[model samples]
Target: MSAALIVLILLAVLAIVVVSMTVKIVPQARSGIVERFGKYRTTLSAGLNIVVPFIDKVRYVIDLREQVVSFPPQPVITEDNLVVSIDTVIYFQVTDPVAATYEIANYIQAIEQLTMTTLRNITGGMTLEHALTSRDQINSGLRGELDSATGKWGIRVNRVELKGIDPPPSIIDAMEQQMRAERNKRAAILTAEGERQSAILTAEGDKQSAILTAEGQRQAQILTAQADRQAQILRSQGEAQAIQTVFQAIHDGNPDQKLLSYQYLQMLPKIAEGDNATTWIIPAELTKALGTLGGTIGSIPVDGGGSKTRVDYDASIEDDVAADTAATNEAVQEALDAAKAAENPATTAADLPSQEEPPPPPPAGGTPQA
Candidate 1:
C-alpha cells in the first residue's frame, strides 16, 4: 500500500493495455476494419495486424470465408394469381471488410431483404406451374441481382438456390387427375388396335381354309368321274369278248342249215322275252327254215324197218353260215366301237360303223310267207 508501488502497478497495467490495442490477432479467413476517429481508415488482414493504440480502432471483424444463409418460406403471388410458398438459400462472401463495415448498417439483413424482393419480382411473372418447374431460372436471376446490389456492401453472392416451391393443394390434385386420364386414354387406344388386328387375321385364316376345302372337293369329283368311265369301258370289253367266243365256237362246229334253223328258233323266245313283245313278227327266212325242217321230218320212214332218206334244202348251208358269220362280225365291230366311245367320246364318230339299209317290214297278221 505504498504510493510508489501503486504507481508502478498502474504503469504495468497501462503498458499492457497499449500493447494489446496496438497489435490485433485476427483469426484465419477473417478481416478487420480500422477507423480513425470514427472514420474508416484501412482494412487489416488476418494475423499480426498493427494500428495506433487509440487513433486507429478496429470497428468490425468480418469473416472473409464463404457463408450460407437459408431464408424462411415466403408467400408470393404468381401470374395466375395463385399464392405459393418458396424458400431459398444463398452462398456469399465478404471481399472488402471496410466497405462491409461502413457501407451498410447490417449487410446480412440487407441481403435477406433483397433476396425476398428479387424472388417476388421473378415469381410474379410466372404461373404456378412454371414457377414450380423453373427453379434454375429463378435461382440464376436471384444470384445476379444479389451480386450486383451487394457489390458496394463488399459482399459477393456466389450462388443462389431455391430449396422448395409448393403449389396449392387443389393444383396438385388436378395435375394427378390429368396424368391418370392421359394414361387411360393411351391404354384404351392400344386395346382397340389389338382387337382390330386380331379380327383381320381371323378373317384371313377362314377365307384360306374355305378356298382349300373347295379345291379338294373339286379334285375328288374329277377322280370319281374318271374311275366310272374306266369301269364302263372294261364292262363293254368283257361283253364283246364273250360274244366273239360264242361266234367262234359256232364257226368251228361247221353247223348246217338245220342246226342253224334250230338255233334261230331257240333265239326267238329270247327276243320275245319282255312283256312288250306281245305282237312280235316272224321273219320270212325263219319260215323257210321251218319248211325245210318239216320236209326233213316228213322224209323219215314211219316204220323202223324202212330206209332213211336225206332231204334237199332250197338254200345251201354254206350261204347261211356265211350270213351268220357276217352278222357276228358286224355285232363284234359295234361292241368294240361302243367300248372305244366310252373310253374317249372325242373319237366316237370316227370309230363307229357305217349304216346299212334295213330289212322290209313283215306282212300283216304277224305271219311270214314261205
Candidate 2:
C-alpha cells in the first residue's frame, strides 16, 4: 500500500510538470518561435499553445507589433569633410516570425547597425548644410534601403527619421551669424525703400505747394493791375466831366471879369500843390486881373438900384466878361506852362507866353479900359 501511494504521488507531480511545460501562454501582440531538437519548427501565436513538453523549446519570442529604436549620435563625414553627429529613430516590425528567428541572430542589433551604415552613406554624399536641411530626404533614402535589405530578415522597416543633426560648434555659430546678416540686409533694404518713398512724397507736396503759391501771386498781380487800370479810367472820365461842365457854364452864363479873376485866384493853391513844384512864377496879367476884380467888387447891382442903372450895369458886366475871357484863359495857360516847365528842364521858355495880346480894338464908341 505504501509503494502504491508513493507511485501515485510521483505520477501526479510529473503530470503537473508536463502540464506546465506543454501549455504556453503568450501575451497579446507577441509571437513565440518553437524549435524542435534545436531546429525551427513553427511559430506559436498568442493565447494557449500546445507543444511537446520535452522535445519542443521556445527559441525566441518576438513582438509582431511595430517597434521603435532610437540610436545614439554617430559622427559622419560629409562631402565637404565636416564631421557631423546625427541621431536616428527607426520603426520596424516583424512580419514573419520563422524568418526572424532563423535568419538574423539579433534583429534589433542588426537593424541598428544597418541604419548607422545607411545613414553614413546618405550623409557622406551631401554637405553639412544639405545634410542639416535634407533630413526628410535622408530619412526616405534610409527607410527605402533599410526596408529592402531588412525585408529578407523578416523585418520590415516602417519608417526612419533623423531625430537630430548637430554640427560642429564653430559651424553652428557661423550659420547663426550668416542668418543674422541676411536679416539685417533685408531690414536695410526695406528701410531704404521707405526713405525713398517718403522723399518722393515730400517733394511732390512741395511742388504742389509752390505751384499753388505762384498761381495765387499771379492772380493777385492781375487783380491789382485791373484795379489800377479801372482807377485811371475813372480819373480820366472825371477830368473830362469837369472840363465839359466848365465850358458849358462859360457859354451859358457869360461870366464877368470878377468871376473870371475869382476863378483864377482859386486855381492858385492847386497849382502850387504839385509834388514837383520848386519855383513860383507870377503871371504878367496879375495886376490887370486884380484891378478888374476891385472895380467890379462894389459895382454888383443891388436890388434897390434903379432899373436903368441895373440894366446898364448888367450890359457892362457882359461886355467885360466877354472881353476878358481870352486874357483869363491865356493867364491860366501860362501858369500851367510854368508848372510843366518847372517839372521838365527840357522845355524852352519861348514855348510859354506869360500874357495874351491886348484885347481887340474896343467896339465902336466903347472906352478902352486901362
TM-score to true structure, per model: 0.54, 0.64
After TM-score superposition, the amount by which residue 146's alpha carbon in candidate 1 deviates from its true location, in angstroms, is 2.2
lDDT by residue (46-151, candidate 2, tens digit) is 9999999999998788899999999999999999999999999999999998888789898889998998899999999999888888988999999999999999
Clashing pairs in 1: none
- Each prediction's number of clashing residue pairs: 0, 0
Off by over 4 Å in 2: 1-9, 180-191, 215-261, 269-370
Clashing pairs in 2: none
lDDT of 1 by residue, 1-370 (tens): 9999999999999999999999999889998888899988888888998899989999888999999999999999999998889999999999888788879999989999999999999999999879878888999998999999999998999999999988789977887898899999999999999999999999999999989899988888888887786565555444544565544454344344466567668988998988988898876786776867644432321212111111122433332434545544665674465345445534432233212321243455452211
Stretches > 4 Å off in candidate 1 = 1-4, 190-370
lDDT of each: 0.74, 0.75
The alpha-carbon RMSD values of the candidates against the true structure, listed in the order shown, are 15.7, 13.7
lDDT of 2 at 52: 97
